[model samples]
Target chain A: MTAMRPDLERTASALFAGAPDWTAIAESGLPRLLVPEAAGGFGGDWGDAEAVLRLAGAAALAQPLAEAMLAARLLADAGVALPAGRVTIAIAQGRVTDGRFTGSAPAVPWGGASDAVLAAVGGELLLLPPGVATPGLSPAGEPRDRLDWQGAAVLAAGRASTSLGKSGVGDSAASEPDLLALAGWARAAQVAGALGAALDLAVDHVNTRVQFGKPLARQQAVQQQLAVLASEVAAAGMASAAAAAALDAGGDCRLALAAAKLRANLAIGRGVAIAHQVHGAIGFTRDYPLQLLTRRLMGWRSEFGSEGAWADRLGALAVARGSAGLWATITG
Target chain B: MVAVFALPPFAFPDDSAALRGDIRAFLARHQPASEPAARANCWAVADPEFSRALGAAGFIGMTWPEAYGGRARSAMARYIILEELLAAGAPVGAHWIADRQTGPLLLRYGSEAQRRRWLPGMAAGEVFACIGLSEPGAGSDLAGVRSRAERVAGGWRLNGQKLWTSGAHHAQVMLALLRSEAGSERQAGLSQFLIPLDTPGITIRPVIDLVGNHDFNEVFFDDVIVPEDALVGVEGDGWRQVTAELAIERSGPERYLSSHALLAALIDSAPQDPAVVRVIGELVAELWTLRQMSMATAAKLAGGEDPVVEAAIVKDLGNSFEQRLPQAIQAVLAADLDGATPLLRCLARLLLVSPSFSLRGGTREVLRGIIARGMGLR
Candidate 1:
């Protein structure tokens, strides 16, 4: 199908936008979207997840929607019973000693607020209840805390034989990179949404806000800047969505994630500069709605890794393929 | 408020892979002998024999109706063939304009007789065509065209000049825009005529480009006469016709793939240096994203909708990507002007000619203006 189900997308958008609560989200089955429909989940693929995350980002929702969806996936892989209320994931190896978990997971999204955290230590997967956290604020003022679990009660624990991370690495070991890729992909999807929303704001402002006897859009310079910004937004959104499609198809997931995140990250400053430039003084104000999207764009751009980190990873991959294989790697 | 722009993932046809394989096989055998440098801007370089071979293999006018020597294929299938040709740097200049825009325009706007006259020969790749939109003072400002065509006995008498008519010397027909309605001006009272290049009182002279290429020409029409049926679509509808035609003109594989040869050359020449690798990686990421956007646009076209905004977006961004590619490479990698390496030569030639990338088809400013208008900007 060339189009997404607009009815389902509208429902997801309604559920995720503007401070949707955990009970509402859980009831809507938004988090369980990745799980199979036969298994009582929404039975959506990664592309669907990409669409929801974009809506969440466009609304600049403070909840850990991405993490909750990811947690459902990890728990499904581990054959753990679905949890009630909010869930989150930490792509770190927590220490497991005699059936209890210890150690801290950094930058866990809404970690203190989640009902449970899906984590792994060594080769074993573990689902632990929410832990006490020293919260750190994201650029958007959202909670991304250093969530500390000191022998926290393990709700469930087991080995996921074939998991998301295992495909990147040969063994069934918990590979941090692939897990991080999943995280990066979610952020990339969110960035795409945020950029589009931001561009809309900039376009509206340019059309309405006037100076020198005409709307700002009447100026050639303004049009050029907005055009470039629009292009960046389009590129970022497409890259992220395509990556989700590639990941769903089980084809070159790592490269897709890397490219998606790198492009999304690179698009941020270029877009922010134009959007803020076009909006003038009001865009820079604290009370303005434009800051919400721009700040989240900044947050998402840095979350998985910096642009340099992704560029380095992607570059090393191209080098391994060599000159001749590079084209095949990209096109194939 | 109108919904924000969104580009969903393109659902390619089920046979995309098989089609791609077939094109690859065809290209490997039918490819002409040319310098490695020729592939970078292969779409502009003519190879009549190669075009004939492609036609014989049933690649030209691929999506046209079977009655016109076409296979009656899907537009997606044609997109695959186009991208494959571009990726491999195949020279497609001989019939590119005809196949890409002129044929499609005629199929939409031409009389049945006109279609019967040109469609078969074009499908066979034996007939070539060029666009005659820009005039002496009408580059991006096409509305400023001063060319005039007067109604006459059994025909229309045309007298005008068109500049930057690419492939005019090699083409059999010229789709020229002229001022048709007397005393009318500015995007009104204009008409398009499918004039034969060999018509009486017509002159085609070469206009060499910065790269020393003679693909461009100045076409002069001094009282040239054509049958009344030569007017495509309706009189005084050239403005609307050409605007619609630009969607086809700007939204093709050529926008981004013109310099693909240089990208391949860079990859072949690059080392394991981190700086170079980082550059290449960013390039790859951007290219991949652009491919997605372009494919989405193609899908829109294939679905029988002329996506004005999407097509402009493709060209606006695609043009920037191609035009900046060579300079980006040369900044990271040193190249001597006298260097004989493929990468070095591609870089030099591309740098010299890349300025035209954004200028041709539609200028970046023009594309952006169209996009801005589509966005509801003032």
Candidate 2:
């Protein structure tokens, strides 16, 4: 299967090129890429949508494109009518009693700005209207609002459909497409993209920045550090791509996504350090775009699941599989 | 913007599974049952008998020409065999150097007569070789090699000392790099010689490593005489040839599999503690990722691409993972240790040998330097 869509890629880059142009993205039909054509949306699969997510990540696009795509897929899967504007998903833990949902989801991506919020609660999908979330900002200054739905009115609620189970058409095996595995892979893809941006910024900075009568890139110390950073980036990219491919193939991808997120987290820990080290004081400034990508990397790594959480999950799975079956599990 | 390094997702051929199964079955038959500590040696153990068995099984010289007593298999086939041998902690060191590097180097640059004379024996695992690159003064800075080879009546006279040469005492042949001309550029004037360890005036003395093993040696070539055919490739091409060989040497399953025995032991005996599980899980994930990258590099080599940068990346990361594996396990075992378990023994042995992980092949610093240049930074 093709791993890229040039048309969607171009639209994503052009629309989210600078500040997040949410209206432009919506008008360009990019948000409908993951929604089924039967729902008056583009008839694209997850593989096609990954191109948009990856490009949005590489450019450090400040929009909630991944969340919007996930929300559309979830709504479409739940057989709910498409919303008018942007949508985001929150895998919240709450109970639905008497047609009211009461829960608090901290740090929901684009929760305040989105036209609708699709919260997953106990195997059911609840579509909540905007303005229910108290707006907040992540450390990276993105719209990571604290969504509180204490007896909040639900626009639509239903069992999130498993018709797409194991088909690779939707994101996860759970009734909702916004489970940890799906979110982990999505964030891993973004982290991979941000790493690319970091590498680019550092490489360009070192090549152009001069010191001691030569370019800083000529220094062995700087060169070695940059190399280490690049290797981490390469590794994170490979892991993320492998996870995406596994998800697209409808394979058992929990382990792949865990590994990808673990690797991505490790890469961010090393990659951001080296990027700033190579760029020196200038990289730490707010004006530099390097901070934009690096900050997002730090934020995305903790979302869906932290490295520790995934590591625990993966480790438990491995132990359950035992040593004799470990190699086969990994290689198979 | 510069394109990121793309390790395009790829899979091994469908038949790789059968090859893996065959190797597994072969290991079940001939694999040695060593204690946990000795098994930690993994690829460092030199067992000529085991090497011969591997050769007889068509595991060695797999990708070489059939005329050279090779099976003419694919690179992935060779990768499968090597990884399996390494993962099982088998003793394949006797022919590891020749099978991995010297054989390929000869096939690429050796003359027809040279190939006809040495390739068959090497493919048969009867011939063993050790690299002679480092000296007392020049370990990573190879261009500073002080060894000299002067033209004599029927051949050349070699004079120099090679230090920290692994498997040299057990090797039948030594690939020595020497300066054949004076007052040339740093990388110029260097030549490679296929010196027999038994040649006159060559003294092979053991240099024990930190692990109390005699695998390393110091070879003193005091006016040793070698025939004209002992010269590998062409004169003044040693630097280029050695660099090409290193691309293969640095990228392999062996680089990361040194501590795998310990990891397997840990997995087999690990408790269900959440903390321990996290560490083990992280290790497994990293190992899987490294294998994917290494296999991709192998595929590239099979396709005849140099992949120097990619190989260096693998070695650097693999070495880091291997060196830190023991300590990571140690952290997990802090609260859960009972002492004298197989896991403890494996960890103890790994701690001793892990220091050499970053030293052998190439130092982490040197490998990073190569990677930087590959990134167009230098």
Candidate 3:
């Protein structure tokens, strides 16, 4: 089955293409889309979330759509009530002493705008009310607010609290969702969408913008560059889609997520370069709209985990399997 | 915005696990212990006995109809076996083209009598075939074929030279693509013929590659005559017929799995270096991703959609992975080339042979162009 529902896809395209508002996204019931039907929410899977996150990325949306949906699912898994306002989950490590969080979630997406940040500190998954969020920003200038809830009272804790798969909160019926990898997966989907947007811009640029008496696309040199760019875009899309399916199937979560994130992170370099290069100085302008995609592509590569970080994780897994098990590991 | 290379959700058949186990068992029992480097370029390693044994076991032609001596299995079923054989580095060179494209082409386009005559032998692995698409004059610009076939009395006379005809020395027949109508050009009036290799005035000369291997050859036809039934499909439909199976041709496990043996060897070497581990890990990640792309392409093809662009994406990406793998390994670990170990030898073998990964099926540039055209860049 396709991950994207037709109606949701059409709405997302229109909504993101224009000004994407959190109210519209939450009002459209996107944050609750992954919650089980028994729990007062849509019983959709990660595949659906994958498509939404991709659209959010394509538009380089400033709204915390990925974070909000993930927080809802994390709450659902913990058997907690869905929050009314926008929310995000802290994927970074923090410590809770005397029912107070002392560590800061350095890069909580839109923490100031979110109603609360669901966090797991020292074996307890707690929802911390927003308290004096220190504003930070991603390379795209989107909100990457720092949440430091010093001596803050816990809003709630889940029925079943366990360490989140990444560094911190959630479990599923089949497989536990690694919050860190989940965040990375969200960015990977975003990277894929951003790459697609960049490729489209580059393709359109080459076909229309005349250079040296012909469209840039007419030159073999330019065509070759675009070909490379297209290959990267296709690869990122494949990797993202594959990981989404793997998570849906309850397959190897860590391996699939690592590969997907790495693939997308690696692709951003060539993809962003070719997209901007074809437009020359015109693309470099603030009004060009190409930077909207290229900037996210540049920042998203290091968002969840940089290429090198994921590569290290994969390498350790590979070495643990050893050479004899390499084939089985790959095929399995 | 477009799903140009969008891979659909796919799962292997429920019985594929058992099917894979059986093939693994068969391979373990029958696979001869050949050279370590041989398995790296295993698909080009011709072993007729191994091929015949595999055929007898029903691995060959598993997807064709039972009436044509096939096992009547699904395409995904056959894909499982094909991948198993490739991953294990079995000598599959002999029946690869015949089982993969030529036999399928004949089944779809050849006459009933032609199918009855040729398919059973091919399914049995007793018959081997090579493609005659590329000639001296037609490499990447495949439409510039100079091969000519004339309608001589009672039959057609073929006169042309086919280049890069892999396994021509062992093939029983050549699925030759030639211009049937006089003075036709650029993919027009082209026709395919099932010309027997032993026909009169035919010569097969080996073309040793840089690695000094005899896997490839040049086949010359001097007025070779074949009966009327030899023509596959209607005249002037050869281009369409050939292009029809390209997605399937480029969508197999052979594209990326070729370099698998080398990765296995590296793991076996047991280098504890983190850099080495990282390289191997990166390769595995890339391989895993490529396989997903391939499976998606396969699913699309099985669903009866012609995923030519998707298949090209797989091939170009897969080939680059294959070509980069050896170099990636070499870059991370300093292999003692002079007193080389097994891993180093496999690296060398792959470094020499992996160049053909892109060259085979279609060049990387050509595949990318197909992807570009599919994206409306052309």
Q: Please, what are the lDDT tens digits per residue for candidate 2 over residues B211-308?
A: 68899999999989999888889899989999888888888998888898888887777577778889998898798789878887888888888888
lDDT (tens digit, per residue) of candidate 2 on A244-317: 67666665566777888888888989888999998889999999988888888888978888889888877887
Note the DockQ of each predicted structure.
0.55, 0.64, 0.59
Q: Quote the true-contact fraction of every model.
A: 0.58, 0.69, 0.61
The DockQ-derived docking category for candidate 1 is medium
Off by over 4 Å in 3: A1-4, A120-126, A149-177, A323-332, B32-35
Q: Any idea what lDDT model 1 has?
A: 0.81
Winner on lDDT between 1 and 3 is: 1
lDDT of 1 by residue, B325-355 (tens): 8887788885576758877888888888888
lDDT string for model 1 (A210-233, tens) is: 799999989989988887888888
Model 3: what TM-score? 0.94
Clashes in predicted model 3: 3
Highest TM-score: which candidate? 3
Q: Which 10 consecutive positions of candidate 3 chain A have the poorest summed lDDT?
A: A160-169
**Interface DockQ of candidate 2:** 0.64
Q: List model 3 lDDT by residue over B283-333, tens digit each.
A: 877888888889888888877888998888888888989999999988987
